[model samples]
Target: MHIKQATPALKAVAALLLTAALSSCGQSQNAGMPAAGPASVGVITLQPQDTVITRELPARISAFTVAEIRPQVGGIIQKRLFTEGSNVKAGQVLYQINPDTYQAAYQTAQASLAKAEATLTSADLKAKRYSQLVEIKAISSQDNDDARAALLQARADVATAKAAVETARINLAYTRITAPVSGRIGKSSVTAGALVTANQTTALATVQQLSTAYVDMTQSSTDLLRLRRDFAKGALQNQSGKAKVKLILEDGSEYAQPGELEFSDITVDSGTGMVTLRATFANPTGELLPGMFVRARLEQGVRHNALLVPQPAVSRNQKGEAVVMVVDRDNKVHARTIKTSQTIGDKWLVDGGLQGGERIVVEGLMKVQDGATVKPEPLKSNASAAK
Candidate 1:
């Protein structure tokens, strides 16, 4: 019986020793795992210089000056002097009206003016002789007064004739239809034989000043208010008050010259809830035409001390907030929530949650979990990451 009890005690001691040995082995394996350190994230250094924030806006081309040419005098179109769809300068003759009748009227007025001047000279001589005779009692005072009145009447007649001559001259000059503005002229509405009236509703042609063009765009009032607030808070600045604009044509080709903002509508449109904005660009080549659809990018403001990060480094949490994996000094990975504002270029602008010089994960994020120990490795360039 004593031998049987010793055998059972020895078995119990062996079992305890085996259990402790297994536990020690497990602890040793855990200790051999490498501790996590700074992750190999694609990082861009924070910049303090001015960075422009641009907004792509849809717009249309417009003319700075447009006019509908009309006739100023009533007459038949004698000749069409210019080719249709040609550039015209101000005061350039465009059409010629028959001036035979107007010329005759002018000559008649000039003859009447000459006759009246002769009558005035004779009346003046008669009035002077009559005045001398009245002083010598050789003529009556009433007769002398009549002679003076005749001279004044002749002078009045000459003045009337002169006015008539001026009127005729103006009518004669009106026979030539000239361009009131310098621009590109459209096709003529009336041909050489067609009769046109003074101030007619139908235009003779259309002229549009395309040397300098206008680009019309719209912006929401809410956006403008937000931008203004940010500007007042020193968060944004229009380093270029009239920031340069870039045009994207319908065919996707960029315009050669840059434009500048010219005007912004004061009142907002109640129907669309947007305010109209205009930009001016020099179109020396006439490539940009009126009513052409276009896309314009306007630089709103520049941000100083901006932090931009790669989009892959940012992830969404359960709350739908953006989060990034940061490696702490203790060589452990920790998930951090960040606040983001807008996007500049291809990266996101981080408003909060990241300090400079902190390493975030750009790769191997799926292989590890929170607080997991890892061996940090350099990120290899791949097609999935930003170029």
Candidate 2:
């Protein structure tokens, strides 16, 4: 019985020793193996290229020409000859006031003019006869002088009568109100038989030329100064022959036709501190209406060598400073602060804080920390990825 117990204890000790030796071997094997390598990140190499810069500004649509139709003379409106919201030609009759009174006045002035002319004829004949009589000593020199003065008075009276007739004719024409400009007419404020006054404050109708439209945009004085400085420094070039502009409607639809920058105000607005810019666009389809809100995309200038980085590669810190992760030659991650001027598509135009040939991390930013080792991978082009 003693031998049997001793054999069982020996077997247990041998099994425990084997388990310890295996555990030690496994620990040595793990220790000898190297740790995992650094994490891999996608990066893009920065390059300088010529780029065109455009600025989008809020703008307001205005008519090329606006005219308010008002009565030149007071009278009862006899008829409204135009349909509301219709295109009208210049000098097109729009309204017909009661012309009965004007016509009668014109006729009366005409009769007065005829009577004055008849009197002048008689005066001229009498003056000539008196001159002949004076020469023959049949009439006194005083009589001839009196006849000549009468003729001059008759001529003056005829001139006054002619002016009255012309005035009456002009008044009669005013009764037929006509469009002063060729454009689209708005709603009429008066109807037939409606009483109107001369030079009334209220307009009978409005006409706006819509064939071509004006887009009035504003830019801050500071920005204008900056742009001028850049131009003076030769940092930007206007490759486009003229200042070209494009429009975006209130509904976010782009206008089919482009526009030209007509002019910019020389003086800044005191109230807003902005300079007004006007662009003219063709509106053959009449899509752009007066007072419509729009946005104008104007090509400001071209930068010869501009550095741009993908927007996704840049991140803002607690202080709201733009920062990016750059992989150095040693494959070490670095946090670099950058100043971005504007966004162009999916990229940001870098104004400072970066140089050419630097590797900017675009992917796997969360996996790596600053100053840590990273495995750099070239970012695939979007076109290649799409394929």
Candidate 3:
């Protein structure tokens, strides 16, 4: 009975020893292998670059020059010379007023001048004859003086008549109306036989130069100040040292040609607190018309050391702050809030909270959280390939 019990104990001890050895072997095997870690994620490293700052503003297309056609002299329109809505050259005749009355007045003034000249001639002969008579005692000294005074009066009358003739001539020439400027003329306000007054309040027609166009835009005073501040701090540099502008048509198409920024209003509008800015563009095809609504993309300046973060990497937190998942030096992920100023293409212009060379998690964001170690894979950019 003792031997049987002893054999059972020995078997139990052997079984225990076998189980312990197997456990130790399994632990050693696992120890030799690597432990599982956090998952991998796609990331992009931040880089500082030079970027241009541009803004689009509401604008209006206008003519480079506008002239209102008005009559300088009052007259009845005899005939319309130029076709309505046609291009006109400077000093081109556009209307013909009836010159009948003016012609008659001119002739009358000429007759008056002739009559005054005849009288002057008679006075001259009488004055000479009277002076000769006085010298020989043929007439009194008083008679010679009277004759000289008549001659002076006659000369004055001739001068006055000559001036009247010139006035009449000018009035006759004014009967024909001409274009004051070279441009596309609008429709005529009055047809032939219609009477018009001199310098009337209503214009007879309008002309606009369409070869070059002006784009008028309004910007807030605050924005203007900010740009000035940037310039003062040297944060922005002008590549061409010129504020270049571009036009966007009403149909959402960009203008083929670029433009130059010309003028800015010194005074801000009190009603809207907006400053008016003007830009000029070449419109050889007459595509830009007066009063047409458009938009202007103004290149403010170029900024250096600009940090751009891809838009896919940005997310808004519960507090409505823009945040991103940043990977640290030790491969640990951290949630960081970033300040973004504007958007450049498909990226956010990172203004604060991140530096160049820092990596941001772009993919597998949902797979990892703060303090989790990750395998970061560099993101391949399509734009780089295109470049």
Candidate 4:
């Protein structure tokens, strides 16, 4: 090799080049290596839980008892004993019809009864005399028989007079129209001086018992059948001995008192294909009125082992099917199509497509795609968030 003398400036330049080459090689190695681990996702572990499912159905408030006040005896209304739109008790006089005619009729019946009694007394004395005469042979047999028949006829007349008196008394009582039930009374259809007929088609007034009211709720026959089937299959349990119901007023405020499901009609409404269900609620304040629209929250049954998934974790795909992202044992994400029937609080009541013990992505869903590898991090439960 030839020995060449190099300058100090050239030697410094060579060192700089070598340093640059090493830096470039290190940068290339870093670029070829993996950037980071799989994306971390917040997930919830699926677990079977007991859930109480309730349905909200439209309902109408009805009075426990309804009475239409009608006149039993025809007469001119003399006075209205009760104030319109006020509470009245059973047997409280609501209207007073003219009793003058009834009183006269009653007096006439009494006079007739007195006359019959006088005749009966005379007939009894004559019959006794006839019996004695027939035994002593003092009177003819034909005369005694005639006397006995007259006595018997007199007794029948007395009985008939007594019945007439009773009828008159009943008619006099009917002059006053009283409430049949204790309840709030509506406006009077007939005022003072209005003539009313016996058993008139038009009512004088109406009274509705409101201390306790009924809520008539209609449910689809299909849904009712499904509930029955579920209960029969033991899929649902009646945790409460009786079904409990809550009322939502028309203004959207919940009624303070809860009610119990009374009974469901056996026959379905042919026109609507619905079953009529009734619930009884206390209306001490008279807040609930008849014909008022409301909603009833009815708890039909409880499911012991139900799979619930957070609502946020569920999404609808292009096909409008409900889907959830679940992590497999290999840490791979999969989009699962699920069947959801209803919402239990903030969770979707999953009917199918998920088994217990699967890790479902609840948060950080935007960062991961289906079939993507992910590192699942256990997320805090939000069970109470719905409430």
Candidate 5:
């Protein structure tokens, strides 16, 4: 019985060995065990770019010119000369006070002026007559002297009357209120028949010159200090030395126009440690308004001849430093640590750890390790394959 069992076991073992040998042979040829070469990978050719670094900051829209209109003379508004919310030019009549009152005063001034002129003429004639009388002794010396004194008094009274006329004319002219600036007028604070006071606490109306608007932004002092430090170290490049700024509205849409950095506050706020910046934009269409919130992009600097790589190619290592896989001329892949400033479009502005003309492993980063050999196809071809 033992010999019979052993014979069957041996047959089973031999069959198992034959099956293993056949499987090995098939795998070696068809299963890609020996004949297959290294797999192809996607890569990007490192190139230099004139990259600009910028900071996006929150901003608020402000009117370039703001005016609070108040009456200069206390009177009832007789007529609203300007339509509410209409554009007005400088010196344009905005409101007409009861011109009847002013006209009457003006006419009174004219009468006073005529009376003063008549008095002046009488004084001149009397003075000439007195001089002739004194020279010819046709009248007593005291009488001539008294006539001269009377003429002098009349001249002084005429001068005083003329001044009163001028004062009355000026007061009459102040009855009509006009716009001091060219701008879009706001709602009428005082309607027709409403009583308005001169330089009163209540404004007659508000006018905002929106032809050119201002976007006021603020940046942290820390960011400014960092930029200054980087500039000092020559790690960053600033085109035009100072950066140009642009705006994005609150709706996340970029403004149709661009703006320049007009001013940066020299003093930083003690509480917020922020420095204010202002950008001016032409708003001829009046699309921008005062107190509208928006975003401003301040172009802090530019990086000349920068080695750019896709953001996907960059990974953070254990120490939190950015690293990318680059293939050398021999197609040997190596992990290079890089210091990046910021992103421009789809790539990062590399500040260090990369030279121009290296093949950066953009797509096949996961497939290759440090010092691994790769067959790098053109990055464009790999991108197309992905799509």
Candidate 6:
């Protein structure tokens, strides 16, 4: 029985030795397979700077000046003097009216003026002779007085005739319809031989000045108020009280010319709760047309010490907040939640959570996790462009 108990003890010791040998062999195999190093990740260092924030609003283009052509006198239109859609200068005659009646009236007034002048000359001679006779006691004082009165009446008649002549001359000149402003004229509403009256309700043609254009942008009153409030709080400085504007065409292309803010309407549209803001732009090529739809982007404010991160480094979390993987000074990876205000190109403008002088991973994101050590490398190309 003692020999059997010793044999069982020997078997137990052999089993324990086998287990130790297996563990040692497994550890040796793991060591020979090569231990994995830290994950390789591409990182970018962020710096703070003053960044301009722009707001885009829908806008419509309008001409700088608009002129409506109308006749100043009553007459039959003799001819249309200008080609439709042609540029016209101020004071340029655009239409010809029948001036025969006005010419006749002018001539009649001139004849009346000449006859009155001749009568005045005769009366003057008679008055002078009567004055001499009266002085020599060769004629009664009442006769001289009557002669002087007749001369005065003749002079008054001449003055009245001169005024009538001037009136007729002005009326004759008005027969020619002229342009009130220099601009491109639209199609004529009245054709040749069309009758027009003085101060007619209908316009003969429309002229629009297109060398410079106006961009009228409509923005919500609430947004405008918020911008004003931000401005007042020193968040934005309206440099020189004029902000620069950028134009975007309907096809999603930016306009070559830049513009400046002109004014903001004080009254809001009751129906839309929106305020109109005007911007002036150079339209030398006439590319901007009146009533054309467009978009205007203008600097709303400047954010000081703002951090911008490359979009590659940013990801969305389960809570829908923007998250980025930040590599700390220890080279350890950590997920960061940051607030973003807007996207400037391919970078996100960080509003909060993350700050300047922090490093964030931009590449090799799949190889990293929270609490994992990483091999950090600078992000290529994007750093120079972002700056």
The residue pairs in collision within model 4 are none
After TM-score superposition, the amount by which residue 259's alpha carbon in candidate 3 deviates from its true location, in angstroms, is 0.6
**How accurate locally, in lDDT, is each candidate?**
0.83, 0.92, 0.90, 0.92, 0.82, 0.90
- How well is each residue in 1-387 modelled by candidate 3, as lDDT tens digits? 889879988999999999999999999999999978778998888777888888889999999999998887888898899988899999999888888988999999999999999999999999999989999999999999999999999999999999999999998988888888899999989998899988899998998999999999999999999999988999899767568999989999999989999989999999999999999999998999999999899989988988888887899999999999999989999999999988766788877999988888988999999889999988787234111
What order do you get sorting by TM-score, best first? 2, 4, 3, 5, 6, 1
Highest TM-score against the true fold, candidate: 2
Residue 138 displacement in candidate 3 (angstroms): 6.6
Compared with the true structure, the alpha-carbon lDDT of candidate 2 equals: 0.92
Model 6 lDDT tens row, 276-384: 9999999989989999999899877786777888888889989999999989999999998889867886788887888767888888999999999999988686466
Tell me which of candidates 3 and 5 scores higher on TM-score. 3
- Report the alpha-carbon TM-score of model 1 versus the true structure: 0.74
Steric overlap count per candidate: 0, 0, 0, 0, 0, 0
Could you report the Cα RMSD, in angstroms, for every candidate shown?
A: 8.1, 4.2, 7.9, 7.1, 5.0, 7.0
Per-candidate TM-scores read: 0.74, 0.88, 0.81, 0.88, 0.77, 0.76
Q: Which regions of candidate 4 fall more than 4 Å away from where they truly are?
A: 1-40, 382-387
Candidate 1, lDDT over the whole model: 0.83
Displacement of the residue 294 alpha carbon in candidate 4, Å: 1.2
Candidate 4 lDDT at 239 equals 68
Ranking 1 against 4 by lDDT, winner = 4
Candidate 3 at 72: error in angstroms? 2.4
Better of 4 and 6 by TM-score: 4
Error of 1 at 356 (Å): 3.9
Error (Å) of candidate 1 at residue 290 is 1.2
lDDT of 6 at 75: 92
Q: For residue 345, what is the lDDT in candidate 6?
A: 68
